[model samples]
Target: MKKFVIFSVVFLSLILAPILFTILSPVILFSKDNVIREFEKNFNTRLPKSTVSEKIYDDYGGFHNDGMKLYKFVFTAEGKKSFVSYIQKQKSWKNLPLSQAYQALIYGGEVKDFSGNITGFGGFAKEVGLPKISKGFWKAIGDRSVVTARFIDYENLDTKTLINLKSFDFYLAIYDTEKGVLYMLKVNT
Candidate 1:
């Protein structure tokens, strides 16, 4: 009877160990640290302690392999300088056009004026659940800021590729040199 009990205990432990580990491990563990880790892993960069504000929405389960992982980091002057320096060093990143930025980041539902001018910035703030940017946000940063971006799992980045994407993984970093504000976005779907 004791031998049977011992065997049963061993069998249960063997079966439950992995399940517990999967539940306990940091892979699916949602926290600020995990958000930072995921961002660092993909962008090959680090976050500074001078962060002003950050919003992270990570629903990507490790084994489940679904849902979106979104992170937005708003940094102080010192942090912006530090991050911008890092981005400037990377060869993969390119200067993103303002029109493309509007389309990609904003997605859809924009309000335009009679002269074919964009009166409203669009639907990303409401739809994607990211932090909201003011109407003047793009215009304020457009000239002074350095907007750089790079796409993951894509060989060529074009209008068609950006439009036809069913799944995406990419990074965009904008540094307002004058305001000393840095905005970094990492999206995986």
Candidate 2:
């Protein structure tokens, strides 16, 4: 009886251990380093040593949880070509001028009067744990910019419609062509 019980326990352990690891691997392995690698793999571009990255927020480690990741990469001319090629293949990207990009992203398509008082109020930064980047930073960006997004609850990237969503999964990528810089953000809530 002892022998049978011991064998049964060992067999169960062998089967269950792998299952447990499979479920827990993401929680255990998700880190800044892994995020960088995932970025390179997903974008099919290598980030140079000078690339600046920050984990603006993280609540739960796994993909299913609420968290945010932000990356800024400055690429050489050659690197830019490779990245652009990859981006061009992607569908549903919107090319926006600097001003519109700022309005849509920072202000969540809020309307402002000439005096610059916000007539409409909705923003993604505060909702997704992103810090308020200075308007000067947006102003300094070159004229040509591209924005693309995916959200769980939001059907489309329309600014006004998205304004009222309290919490949802969000992924946004902005590429500044003139500066060869790319900013990628992912928020899951």
Candidate 3:
């Protein structure tokens, strides 16, 4: 009986391995149109078509097989305040106090790990009235702010928004008193 069980288990493992890998771990393929589609599909809202944006792909882990691609769109709103004001109106997103929000984010969202640091200014930093780049925009990946919990664990709408912040990728989007824009960010795992 022991021999039979062992053989059965081994046989099953060998047979299922290929199928499991192919289904569980898939190579993701996408584009701007795909991004808009995915964003709309996931968020249940239309991704605004008017923004100027592009797709960025970075080869990761020193291998072509390990890579990630994401999208970025700069708004025509002109300043941090305008951008923030626009996004604030999104009911799906909740703005949290940046300093305190980091520690609380891990418990509520689909994101397993989130961390970030203030990096520097965007190209529009000067035009946006940023005197110091770091103080204006924080450059970070795995951003903790502007985060939207993408992974849904329960069907309840409350559960989906239990966290106070909303970010699809939480790519940095900070605007200060002068509407100084500071945020450079991207992350996926």
Candidate 4:
């Protein structure tokens, strides 16, 4: 009886140790500012010097089992606008266009507009002021378009990091004067 109890205890401890670590580990250590640093390092883009605005909202389990805490930052650079976020619960980061973030900032209240195709896939388009122009107009400009960087977890939800990590997907719709062209850029890092 004593041997059986000892064996059970040891087996249970071994199984539960990793689970406990996963649950207790911080999902995200980066904040809105940290996201800017990462973006600069990876993309070679510079953020505006002016103070960027940020708001935190709950994801309601949209991105993960424990749900996500989204931080939205708004700023303008080179006469263009942009936004970025650090998804705490999802352990990922995102950069959005200024217009989309503004729209959500204004009418959407605190709720975020997530893409149906993927849980954490969505971003803002550059603000063009006019209705029709802002919808997808950035794609029309040779220089502007909606861009998204996504990180997905492919393993058991209980695990701290997803297994079988996939390549990152960056999407952009470039608009020439006559028509719009969609471009998908896949990169592995």
lDDT to native, each model: 0.50, 0.53, 0.38, 0.31
Output the number of the TM-score-best candidate: 1
Best first by TM-score, ranked: 1, 2, 3, 4
**Which of candidates 1 and 3 reaches a greater lDDT?**
1
Question: TM-score for all predictions?
Answer: 0.49, 0.48, 0.33, 0.25
Q: Residue 41 CA error for candidate 2 (Å)?
A: 7.2
In candidate 3, residue 98 scores what lDDT?
A: 35
TM-score of 3: 0.33
Per-residue C-alpha lDDT of model 4 across residues 46-140, encoded as one tens digit per residue: 54565352433433333222222223334444213332221212222222232332333212323222332222222222121111222222211
- Cα lDDT over the full model 3: 0.38
Better of 1 and 3 by TM-score: 1
Candidate 1 segments whose C-alpha is farther than 4 A from its true place: 1-29, 49-53, 59-64, 95-102, 109-125, 131-156, 169-189
Listed per model in order, the count of residue pairs whose N, CA or C atoms clash below 3 Å is 0, 0, 7, 0
Summarize candidate 3's per-residue lDDT along 1-189 as a digit string, tens digits. 999999999999999998987776544343346555544444444434354445544434643232333344444545444655555576544343232232123212132222432222122223322133223222222323223333432112232232432322333333343433322323322
Alpha carbon lDDT of residue 187, candidate 4?
A: 19
Regions of candidate 3 where Cα sits further than 4 Å from its true position:
1-29, 60-67, 77-86, 96-188
Candidate closest to the true structure, highest lDDT:
2
Q: Which tens-of-lDDT digit does each residue in 1-189 have in candidate 1?
A: 999999999999999999999887865675566666655565556778745445555555654353444455567667777766766676654443334434544455444444555533343434546444332122111111112223323324444434444544554444444555545454444
